[model samples]
Target: METININLTNGYSIKSLCADDFNIVKELCEKCSDYYLLIEGVLPSKKDVDEIFIDLPPNKSYEDKYVLGIFKYDELAGIVDIVRDFPDAGEWMLGLMLIKIDERGNGLGRNVHRALSEWASNLGAKSFRIGVVIDNHKAMKFWSNLGYKKIKEVDMEFTAKKHTVNVMRLQLDE
Candidate 1:
């Protein structure tokens, strides 16, 4: 998959993440750890983050899963992961999405969202589903502005934090 790189106001280039970007990915994940803890109610240890890098699934490798990264210059800025629903489920899951705090407001999120949606559409996905924490008003508003509506809510338990989070889904098809 080809991704066009764009230079942000900070002179960082948003591009596709490659296999050799483990260090950058690790840094981004580390810097954004607190944000994830507050928003997702789970704090991932450095080992957990390292394991995530070790287990990154290849992009466009299967009909059901996709993983994409956003890079800033030579560093990793954000990531988005999608997985198709189980048979008869009729939806695709927007599994994971994260953007570094420094790169938050300069339209990188929208760009990543558009790129992922386009990829999903190309892969025959009719809709995209995501879960957001109810307390994350900023994220809730962001997703809503991107045409995602809350379809349902469920309680999820995070073992690392032992906190119950509210999960919300957004349907991509309009």
Candidate 2:
């Protein structure tokens, strides 16, 4: 696939992530979702993060995966992974999203979310699914405000731990 770059209103850009960017992307995920690590009872490690991405869920299949790095002034600012045509017809999985620790609550997420939604819709997708950690209030609200409604409460096992996952979807068929 060709490298696609999306420029945000806030001067950040999202481009295809390469293998060499894993470390910084891992650091971004760790810092943004520190709560996950706390609950997993393990500190951050390259292996842990690699495992999560390397062997992502079935919906996030190898060929359909689009791992994008959010960049700002030549630095990694966030990451987004998308799996096209997953779990259902005309739908895609918004697998992972993480912004830098210092960049939260500034409308950056909304811009990124909007860009991705538009991108998917243009690609013929009808909806997008996101699995939100049920108890993460910030993330829950963020997804909700983006018009994603919780459709189910699913149990998920990740990194050897079980937790409730709120399966949410944003309809793009309008």
Candidate 3:
């Protein structure tokens, strides 16, 4: 699939994520999850990072997987992915949506969400789902602003700590 660039007011753009972005994605994930209850406490070793990276499917390879990067003047600022999975419903899940700390507060999250939603719609997704850690109020608020409503909760274990995460969903065709 071709990556469509989203022009920003500051002259940067949002582009589709590629395999070449693995290193940046790894770094961004590590740093962004510093305060995440699940990752911060569970992933206490470098091996954890490696394991997580290894588990990710190749970028844009799966028929229902799409990853995107937020860029500022050619610098990677953040990333987001949509994976269509079916456990009960044909759902598209948002994964690893992150913005570099310094590059945040410029409405990048909204832009990324818009881009991902468009991509999901093109994929014929019926609903969009995302899991947010209970402690991550900022993310909860952001997802809420994008019209996601809390639908379920799960007790997730990472490292040795337990976290209650809210699974939020948005009906796409509504």
Candidate 4:
């Protein structure tokens, strides 16, 4: 992956995270127990943290994935697992985006999304894709508010539980 600048306002910095930051990412997940509970019905495990860096869709490689950490003053505050050209060419897939529990409702998520959007646009992305668990209404609203429209809903198994996912997309400008 080439160097990409993510301009986050409010003293936040975004950078690609690596294995050395596993504990930091795990700690962030621990802080986001509510989200995991809502989606997986359990707190994050070591395997879950590992999946953050290893999991990939069919035909996608590690080279196509970017595990980005959102930080403030050197403290990891959030994470985003994004894949370039996933599902199709000219598209980007947002596998996950999580903000620390205390960081919610402060507009940090929106700022991160905006920065990522601009970055994607600069990369010549034609659109962006994301899948939100149907039960995660707050996330659904967030994506919808950002101009993502529902492309479809599919039943899928996640963490050994059946889930309905709302696959949404935002078409970028030419």
Models, CA RMSD each: 4.4, 2.0, 3.6, 1.3
Winning candidate number (TM-score): 4
Computed on alpha carbons, the lDDT of every model, listed in order, comes to 0.63, 0.79, 0.70, 0.89
Off by more than 4 A, model 1: 1-21, 39-43, 50-63, 86-90, 160-173
Clashes of 4: 0
Point to the candidate with the largest lDDT. 4
Query: Where does candidate 2 stray beyond 4 Å?
Result: none
| Residues 69-173, model 3: lDDT tens digits | 778887778776666763334677776677878877778778767766776677677888888887887888888988999999999876667789999998887
In each prediction, how many residue pairs overlap at the backbone (N, C-alpha, C within less than 3 A)? 1, 0, 1, 0
Deviation of model 2 at 123, angstroms: 1.0
Q: Is candidate 1 or candidate 4 better by TM-score?
A: 4
What TM-score fits each model?
Answer: 0.72, 0.89, 0.78, 0.95
- Tell me which of candidates 1 and 2 scores higher on TM-score: 2
For model 4, how does the per-residue alpha-carbon lDDT over 63-168 read when each residue is reduced to its tens digit? 8999999988689999999998989998999999999978888999988988888887887788999999989989988999989999999998867577899999
Please give the RMSD of candidate 1 to the true structure. 4.4
Off by over 4 Å in 4: 3-5
Which of the two, 1 or 4, has more lDDT? Answer: 4
Q: State how far residue 107 of model 2 sits from its true place (Å).
A: 0.3
